[model samples]
Target: MKGKIIFFSVFFLLTTGAISAQAKNAPRSIISTTALIRKYHDQKELSGMQKGELLELYIERIKVLVKTLPYIALVTKPGVTMADLGIPDDSEHKKSLENQALGTSTFLDTTVDFQRKMMPYSDKANLIAAILFYEGTLKSLHEFNELNEM
Candidate 1:
């Protein structure tokens, strides 16, 4: 009985410690686009490295968004084919998109790893602003495409 009691106590302590550690290391929540824009306006001029990081984030996000173009068309427009979105129905195009997705996935992994390493406050605002800008641009493009189709 004493052995079983000691084992449970040890397990409980280990689990609690692990939980607390994970809580401490949890990723920060994503800030809103509005807040990011506000912060971006207040930021000082970015250094070359910061500009490079921002550009990388923007390009990676655009690649991912492009990968979703076909699916977005299918859902938003009934009976729409890939050709309607100017996406080739051939295997080569499919393979190219798949390859792009894999590359984008790798870029995202490295980005998340960097963020986990505690990126600088200045870099974070620039990164977030780039993300918001690209996302908004894609949204606007999608809307424009829809209007043109009508």
Candidate 2:
């Protein structure tokens, strides 16, 4: 009986430690397009921030949709396009762009809402970190877009 209890206690401790480690290393919460816009206004490089926020928001949104949408088989099939994510490809890229923008905006709004709710409980540093990350992500995306365009 004593041996069993010791084994169980050790197993519990190891499992809890592993869970704690994973939780700590998990990626930060997703950033939204609106949050990116706010960050852009807060910083001098508006375009860079805008791009980063948009890309990150899109990727995260895609991940969620892929998980929840049953009909989205191509999501994991590889070599998918915006159309796979419900963006229609037609004459002009306008429609696709619009859909992307709307999706990103919605994602950002959700993030902002969550941030506001946690404001009273979370540390200021966490909020700041989140903002910085969003801005940084936008900056990187902007650079990549510029390169592709060039």
Candidate 3:
């Protein structure tokens, strides 16, 4: 009886440890951008570094998912340059996109007449984080509008 109890106890301990290790090593499921923003929004306060870290994580996931995103067809006639469509040159566009990825661009955060609303965060990191949430909300709204229009 004593030997059987010892064996069962050891077996239980080993199984529990293995289960815990597996849980610790498990990869977290990816949630939607809006859901991520909502998770952060629920927090009462987040330091600039924390916000920046979240933004970096968000950007990394976006980079990973780029290949899976829908393609935008850019059809143009012969001899038509990007400038004809008011699009900046390659270098300028690259810089602009980089700023956008960093969530520091004012152009996209403005109204039709370029009227800008002040963001809550004054620090760059916090501002970038706030912009991440703002952009996510805007993207969701645009998608919703498109579906309704269709």
Q: For this target, which candidate reaches the highest lDDT against the unseen true structure?
A: 1
Q: Candidate 1 at residue 142, lDDT?
A: 59
Model 2 residue 42 CA deviation (Å) reads 8.9
Clashing pairs in 3: none
Q: What's the TM-score of each model vs. the native?
A: 0.34, 0.33, 0.25
Over the stretch 24-67, how does candidate 1's per-residue lDDT look in tens digits? 65432111111112223212443333555665555555554544
Give the number of the best model, judged by TM-score: 1
Q: Model 2 over residues 1-150: C-alpha lDDT tens digits?
A: 999999999999999999999976543222222122322434333334444354444334334332223322323222344554565455355454455556756765686566445554644444445555655655555565466556
Q: For model 2, where is the 10-residue window of minimal lDDT?
A: 29-38
Estimate every model's Cα lDDT from 0 to 1.
0.54, 0.47, 0.43
At residue 137, give the lDDT of candidate 2.
Answer: 55
Estimate the lDDT of model 2.
0.47
RMSD (CA, Å), each prediction: 12.6, 18.1, 16.5
Residue-level lDDT for 145 in candidate 3: 45
